[model samples]
Target: MDAAESLRLAARSIRGHKLRAALTALGIVIGIAAVITFVTLGASVKAEVVGQFDDSPANRVFLVATPGDDGGPPAALSQPVFTEYDVGRIGEFEGVDRVVPRGTIATSALSRGGETVARDQVTATTPALFESVTFREGGAFADASSGEACPAEMAVTPSAAALFPGNLSVGDRVSITQRGNRTRNVTVVGVLADDAGLNPLAGFGSRPRFYLPTCAYDTVVTSPTTGTRQNVYPQVTVIAANPGDTAAVQTRVQDYLDTESDAAQLAPGSYEVSARTNEDIVERIENVVDRLTQFVTGIAVISLLVGAIGIANIMLVSVRERTKEIGIMKAVGATNRDVLQLFLVEALLLGVGGAVLGVPIGVAGGWVAVTYAELPLTLPLVWVGAAIGIGLVVGVVSGLYPAWSAARVDPIDALRYE
Candidate 1:
């Protein structure tokens, strides 16, 4: 018999017992589906995380404070506590890019119009921040002029703007009331917009922004001492020369801070350093997700292996039941290869068929996971292709032993047995 005839016979056999065929391929279906879904999602997560740097300049870096000898908690690390000089010294490094000295004013004040909300660190930064950090709504401020009070003007985040009439427009006024019943009225100047897919306002205690010039601090911050201009220290922030240059910048900044006679003088406590590039945190998240995808896919494959075994067993039984038929075919001059092809085709069809049907099932499963699980859907294309390939290989290999056995039966003994 030709290969075409063997394939036809396999097809007809599968049609004759549709339910049995479907049940036999069930494990393969589930396994392929699981694998495809996981790989695709994993890849997507990886891309999303790395994308944070898409809008940044080739080189931009952010530096926060190092804890003092008595480190406040790990959570405090994120707290705006770094000195402005720390960022200044970091910028002093060779190949160093411009640095944006920033400080987040942390304290709530009542606005004159009764739009009262406790704002988290009200940031005072130089215009250099425009290149350092991405905005999702309004823009950042201009460079703080030396010895000049920061403009009464401020930039607001979309979330922060939502609280008032028409949001914080370029000319709106916000009042910052501080201790001793004092208040400072500041004008809104800019808005920021971004597509990093993050909650644009996840920071600032979930309140909207009211960006102010450093000079605005004079109104809210009472000088703690006789000679200090403002009590707020800069939360060290630096823009990188390029994404690739982050490691170099980090080293330079660390070395600079370590050498600071003032930094070394900080109250004795363990000093820890942590740096996050534009995409570093996101990459970390994606890695954890990819690991999880692999772990789950491993479990699904076991079921597929079992299904292949079932196929092998079924083919063996068919060989036994058709012993007389096998002998008759041999007597008619049919080669062992022809007999083997017939059974092998059937097994291949079962495996491949299951895989084809399960792809859509897996895609639908991913849809459900994204919508309900609240995870961003990320597709891993390579994983899907591998899953399908695995299915076909499993089918062919499982039929091998049974097909070989059927082909080896002796013609003479088989003809007399029935």
Candidate 2:
């Protein structure tokens, strides 16, 4: 028989037993859907995370203090390691354009016009921190470089501004309560643009925050052992002189902290310094997502195996039921190759149908998941093609034994026994 004739015969045989064919292809549908869904979701998560850096400065590097492996509890958590002196010295390093010390102060509430919003902590950094960010209202407050002390002016993110009854604008005075019930009223000098791309220290997601000069939080972060107020920092941001020089500057900053910095001089082998760029962080996040995708994909492979077995089982039953038809076909000058082709095509059709159906289901599944999670939608088109290929291969391999059995059946016995 010709190839088209074989396809017609195979499809007619499948259509004769619609429920059985549907049941047999269910495993394949589930497997392909699962693989596509997970892979698409994984890609979307990576895209969302990496997209956060799209607006960030390429020359910015973060210097963080961590505890050494030989520690009891985390030393950096127990005591402040990076001081104002350390930040100043880093600013003087070669290839270093600017350094901003980020310190957090325990805050109770921010109040304006009898309206109050509670807060945990507020970040304190220099006015230079806002140079790269766009302002919606006023500009960045003047730093001490202008022959005046850092002013008691604050910049607020859009999320922070929304916490009040009316969105905060320039020249608005709000009372800030710090640790120990220290209340200080500061003027809102700037409101950051909505898409300000203000990356917080330690990889915290974008959220409501207010910024002031590092000096404002001096009394809030006093040294525990010394009982004295010090402008200590857990994180510092350094900017390289040029955009592409961050890697070299990061290396130098790490080496300096390890060998010559106060953290090294005061307590040797007790503190570990980390200097990382935005690209470094994005690469690390991608690696983690890739590993997780591999692990989930492995589980989906088991479902494919079960699907292949289902196809084989259904094909075997089909051969047995059509024994008389096979015998008659062989008696009428039908070749063994023709009979095998007929059976294989039936299995192939089932697999291909399952794959085609599963793709859209998987895509819808991925879309719903990402939408609910508030992440960007990313389609795994490459995986869609792979899934179809997988289905074709599965059908061919599963139908092999059944097709061979049908081809080898005795025409005389098959006709007489039935």
Candidate 3:
């Protein structure tokens, strides 16, 4: 018999035993579905994380202060903290476009009636900060007018505005109480839209942040030891002159910090300066997602192995039950290759049928899981093709032993048996 004739006979045999064929393909269907679901969801998660990073300014770099050996805040008096002067020096470096110093103060916001609204961390920063960070609904940073000693203008987050009795808007008054029972009433210059997805601070339970001019922040919140106003920045953000200059700018900034005058005041190894771009963070997240995808997919491979074994077992039974039929085919001028092809084609059909049902189920399962987890839906076509290919291979390999056994039966002995 030719190849086509063998395939036709295989299809007829499978149709005659519909229930048995379906049962044998069940393992394959489950295995493929599991693999596709996990792989697709993994891809979606990675994409969501990377997309968040992409939304932020790519050319901006963050510089954070290192803690002391005891895990406490670095000695404020001994260790050098970034200030406006330091920001100026950093900005002077080649390829540096701008530098914004950020200071954090813990305070409770109050209404005009003296009712407490919420306790949150307020950031004291330069107007240059508006160059990098995006606001949901605002124009520019409130001008702290050049030569002004202290400006009471402030920008409050949407979450912070919601805490007030009525809707908060520009030109409103927000009273805040700082440490040492000092209270300051500041004018609302702008309302900051929530960019939680793109802001790293959102991860640390950052309550509604209120932005204040650095000058006003110093007047209300001063250092205890000095008893004088000073800029004690815990973090500084740097914007590169151009997108392509980010790497060079980062290196120059780190090198400048090492040799800057501020370094001379610090004890050796008491503090360190580090800088990172958004791309660095994205790469780290991708690495984590890739490892997780591989681990879960490994488990799915075990399921496919079990399905392959089931296919082999069922093919063996089929060979035993059709022993007389095989002998009759051989007597009728069917070669061993023809008999082998017949069994192999039947196994292939089982795999193809299972994949047809499994792929859609896998897509649906991935969609539901990703939606529950609040991740973007990203279907990976490459993985889908791979899953189908795997099913086909498993089906063919599973039939090899049974096909060989059926082909080896002698024509004479088989024809005499009942």
Candidate 4:
């Protein structure tokens, strides 16, 4: 038979046993859908997670003090803190352009226009931190001179600005009560863009944050450690003058922290200081996501194999049931090749049908998951194409033996069979 006639006959046979055809194709549908859904979701999650760190400047390096070999608790816990002395010396390092002290204090409450919101974070860093940050409203806090105190200025994140009855505007005064019971009033100078220079560690964007100048940080919040001075920083972010010099700068900073810094002299074996570039951290994170995606995709591939077996099983049964029909076709001068083509075409139709149904279902499933998780949606078009190809391969391979068996049937025995 010609290709078109073969297809017409195969389609007629499938339609004649609609329920059996549907059942036979179900495994392929599930397999393709599983592969597509996981791949799409994996890509989307990876994109969303990596995108958060995109704003991090390539020249930036983060410094942290850990307790001995232990990484220590979150930066807020102040296991071994960097002091103002460390920040000043790091800034003077050969390739260091600037150093921003990353000190955060837990606040009891934030008050704006008589409305109160509870338990948020207020971070203190230098005005230089905002150099590349985009603001949604107003502008960066006025640069505080070296000798003068910071100008009671603060910047609020968009989430923070909307915490009150009415959205806070530039120049609005707000009171922040720190966990230490110290209350400081500061004017809002800027509001950060929703996606601009976000803290990657902040789980979702809903948490409110207020930024203050490092000079004013001590006046508002107490140090997390009792004996440590208020000037002690939980962490420090360093910007290298050039991206290529980042490694040299990191080495110099670590060497100084280990040998010359006060924390080094005081704690010695009890604490360790480490400086790492943004690129290093980001690469580590990407590696983890890639491994997870590969692992899940492997699981999906096994399901596809199961689908291939299902196709093979159903095709064998199909060959047995169509024995009489095959004999009549052969009696009418049909060649073995024609009979094989007809059976193969039927399997292909089933596989293609499942693929067509599966792709949309998988995409819809991925979209729903990402939407519910509030993550960026990414469609893995490559996986979609692969899924289609996989279906076709499964059809041909699974139907091969069955088609051969049907073609080998003798006309005399088939004709006499009930």
Candidate 5:
């Protein structure tokens, strides 16, 4: 039969038993829908990760201090907390880049107006620390006119500024508490629009970094209150030699700590130091999403497999019901191939119809779900193309055995059937 006639006949056959055809295609529809939704969601997550980290400015090395090493998986290591001395020495190695030390004091306090306040971010650093980061702010701590009287100078982030009273200008006094017991008076020297956002939703990292100028940090440490003070150990952070040299800069930092720092063991197996490129964060996120998509798609594949079995069963019934018709066609001019093609064409049409209908439904559903639920939408062209190809193959392959069984029926016996 010609292509035109085959398609027309296939359409008629499907129309003849529309209900059974619909029931059989139902499994395929559900399966393809599931695969499309999950894969798209995973791809969207990957795209978001890339958008966030691909052009970031922060250094990627982490120096974590822990207890004695238990020789097992690469878990936490054993070392005392890193110190200013360790941070300073990291800048001397071959690949070494500039390092910034970060520390935090989480607390709640009242502004001078007796308003309740809470802040969890405090970084003790110099004017250089502010310059090293991407700040959306009026300015960093150096610009603040914090004298000795207000030794606890803090740069308030825009998010924190909202909790304060009106006329909340720079140089306002806010009483901040540390560890819930100490309510120390801190200066609001500068206000940053946003320092960090952990998610697309406006959330902050540990109360937005409140800063103390390096010059007065020691004095603030020694004199916590009017007279009391405590040593606040700083967490070490490094900026790359440049934007592209994150890996090289991380190596230099590790080398410097190994040869020069007092805690030599920290450079070895005693501490956890991690180096990452901006793109590395995206790759990690994509990996997670891919795993989730595969899990969902596996369930969908089972449904498609069941649908294929239904196609086979339905074709067997079709061949049996029309046995005399087949015998008459064979006795005339029809070849075995023509008889097989007729059955195959009908099965192929079912898949082609499903693909034509299913892909758009899947795409539309993706858009609606993403827009309403606020999920990012990302299109991975390669995965999509692969899915389309898979659908075509499934259609042809699922039709094959049934077509073969119908063609193999002996004409004499088929003619004698009741």
Candidate 6:
């Protein structure tokens, strides 16, 4: 018989024993569904993380401070104190475009009406930092062009502005109190948009936040020991001249800091200066996702193995029950290859049926899980294809021994027994 005839016979046999066929296919359905669901959820989480990184500044590099050996704060003498002057010096580097110093302090805002909003995260940065962010209200960081000792001007997030008494509008003035009762009256020159893409403290739950020019921030906040106001920024963001030059610039910046005269004054390894690019962050996140996916996929593979064993068991039972029919076919005209192909087609049909049913179920389950987790919804097409292919392979391999046994049956003995 031709291959088409063999396939038709296989279908007829499957339909004839509907219960057995369904039982055989149940294993395959469960395995395929498990694999698809895990793989889809993993892909969605990875996509969400990568999307957040993509939303950040592209060509920017971050300079972060690492703790000292004892796990306490770095020794004061060894501390790499970053000031506005250091920002200017870093900006003078070959591939450096702009340098923005960043510092944060917990402060309370006292509205002009004497009402206070406390526990606000106040950031000190330059107007250049505003270039990368969106503003829901007003313009860029209020320019500190007045040359006054402290230009009391700031920008506030919508959430932060709501904390102040009265309608917080642009051009309003509020008093900010930092540690040690240091206070400064500032004008709200701008309001940050709600969707300010990746801020440093985004991982921390939502809190009131505002931005002030570095100069203004230094004036309102003073060092505990110095008793004099100085620009003490904890982190410095270096914007590379070109996106493609970030890596090279990062290297140069690191080398300069490590070997620079002022930096050399600190003890070796007293404090470590690390630079991270957007790509670096994204790569780390993807690596973590890949490891997690592999772990979950390993469990899914176990399910597939179980399904394969179940398929083999069912196919073996089918072979024994159909022995008389097999003998008759052999006696009439069927060759060993024909008997083998017939049984194999039956297994393939089971696999195809499981794949058709399981894929949709897995997709629907994945969608619900991702939605509940608040992750980006992503369809893993590659994993879907893989699931189907795995199902077919499992079916073929499971039917192999049974098919072989059927093909090798002695026609004369089988007919006499019947």
**Span of ten consecutive residues with least summed lDDT in model 3:** 71-80
- Residue by residue across 157-205, what tens digits does model 2's lDDT show? 8888888977988999999999899988889999888734465343435
Q: Please, what is the whole-model Cα lDDT of each candidate in the order they appear?
A: 0.63, 0.80, 0.73, 0.78, 0.60, 0.74
Clashing pairs for predicted structure model 6, backbone only? none
Question: Which 10-residue window of candidate 4 scores lowest in summed lDDT?
Answer: 71-80
Regions of model 1 farther than 4 Å from truth: 62-82, 101-127, 131-154, 163-166, 171-187, 193-237, 240-251, 257-289, 300-303, 306-338, 367-381, 401-418
Ranking by TM-score: 2, 4, 6, 5, 3, 1
lDDT of 1 by residue, 123-177 (tens): 6666665554556545666656676665666776667677665566666677876
lDDT of 3 at 74: 20
Ten contiguous residues minimizing lDDT sum, candidate 6? 69-78
Candidate 4 global CA lDDT score: 0.78
lDDT of 1: 0.63
How many clashes does each candidate structure show, in the order listed? Answer: 29, 0, 0, 0, 3, 0
State which candidate, 4 or 6, has the greater lDDT.
Answer: 4
Best prediction by TM-score: 2
| Per-residue accuracy of model 6 over 335-410 as CA lDDT, tens digit each | 9999999998888888878876778888888898898888878999988887888888888998888999989888
Top candidate (lDDT): 2
Evaluated against the true structure, the overall lDDT of model 5 is 0.60
Task: Pick the winner on lDDT between candidates 1 and 3.
Answer: 3
Clash pairs, model 5 backbone: 67-78, 224-228, 224-229
Winner on lDDT (2 vs 6): 2
lDDT of 4 by residue, 1-418 (tens): 6899999999999999999899878888888888888888889987876776665667777776656544323233334357777777788889888888767766888888678888667887778777778888988887765667668888888877887777888989988898678898899999988734454533334567788877666532233333456476757788899989988888888888777775465444656666767665556566767777889878977887888888888999999988999999999998999999999989888887888788888899889888987888999999888878888888898889999999999998988767
